[model samples]
Target: EAQIMAEPSGNELASAAAKGDLVQLTNLLQKNVNVNAQNGFGRTALQVMKLGNPEIARRLLMSGANPNLKDSTGFAVIHDVARAGFLDTLQTLLEFHADVNIEDAEGNLPLHLAAQEGHVRVVEFLLRRTPTMGNKTLPRARSPLPYFGVRG
Candidate 1:
């Protein structure tokens, strides 16, 4: 009975997504749960989803999850996808129209994060899709991708 009066939140959805539990996630989506609701950590399901799973991203995006929503850390899911070298997941995000150039709290783009992590494939991909050309301005003086052969 108490469960009926509980406030709705995306904790369950985010948990399922973080665990890659497609079944449970689907169940929640079918119930018309708020796809954009923040979890206990103040992050949307798409924000905290398993970064390596494109299928999870696909389902969430199809279910009305906002790919561009930032978490408490001022990071969109693409930032994590890039930093973690999840190429397929990054592709999924792009297909959903996530802003490739979205800046993090530190004012670094996903490209910067991917480059910093030395994710060569992700860097190459971002370089092709990012619209800034070579003139992207950062809050800091230099790129974090010295090892990736990138100049500041």
Candidate 2:
């Protein structure tokens, strides 16, 4: 027989993060409920930032949430922000030193994801930081077209 683990509350810390309820999140964190905890879908507080709450994401980072944790699909917080074209969230994650070169399971980096969504400013911002990406190959292959498909 397999033992079943009870699911965490639907209104858990991450949910508070999704709602931008920093006060409740702070309280939860104080209780030591794994700041890096993922939801059933493997989404973290940083991934929830793409829901239009840069400030909440920043607060979570300050509270010690790991920015690099990925979802079940290997999508990092930066990837979510890039996909959603949330420049503010992207900048905040970058400032916290989130891994720019990290790829999802599909090998798509944040720049690649940004390009796929046609977020021009995001592409520029990521390109401007390529030298810091520490890998020469990325700067040379920074064109968005390679990652983003041609639109009709």
Candidate 3:
């Protein structure tokens, strides 16, 4: 009856990821549950991984999760990683080819989120990898500010 166990729902997957339960997650994936399945908030396992578990995120990405998939707010997993200052998670996402310049609805990139959160190390890492990222203006800037923070 093992095969008859109920398939993990989207909420289950989200919870497993949130709890960093790699074993359960792997089992669900092996059962062919949708890795990209979103919870009620349209958040995939990858997004939840950004909250705490880079290892889980890594496994999801390796299993072919779409790194660029956006949540309800147009925030991708990279956006979450950047905002939280999860440098290792960000690096793993980058290794999976997560778009460095992906913009949210407001035209804010991961760099913008990192800057807004005052993640200096994240910002420096992003700048080192994508120098042009800093030059881009935020959503409604009347003049080019070269950054997202409030000007002095």
Reference-based TM-score of each model: 0.87, 0.78, 0.83
- Deviation in Å, model 1, residue 97 alpha carbon: 0.4
TM-score quality measure for candidate 2: 0.78
Local accuracy of candidate 3 as per-residue lDDT tens digits, 46-146: 88763657789888988889999999878888888898998988898999999888888887778778877788888888867766654664355422234
- Tell me which of candidates 1 and 2 scores higher on TM-score: 1
- What is the model-wide C-alpha lDDT for candidate 1? 0.85
Writing each residue's lDDT as its tens digit, candidate 1 over 1-152 gives: 43553444689889999999999888788878899999888998898888899999999999888888888789999999999999999999999999987889988789888888889998889878974644656444445557566555
Segments of candidate 1 deviating more than 4 angstroms:
1-8, 133-140, 150-152
Return model 3's CA RMSD, one decimal.
3.3
Candidate lDDT values, in order = 0.85, 0.75, 0.80
lDDT of 3 at 99: 89
After TM-score superposition, the amount by which residue 78's alpha carbon in candidate 1 deviates from its true location, in angstroms, is 0.6
lDDT of 2 by residue, 1-152 (tens): 97654544423877888878878777676666666777666777667643567888888788778888887878888888888888888888888889888889977778777887889889888878764554645444554656555431
Off by over 4 Å in 2: 1-11, 132-142, 145-152
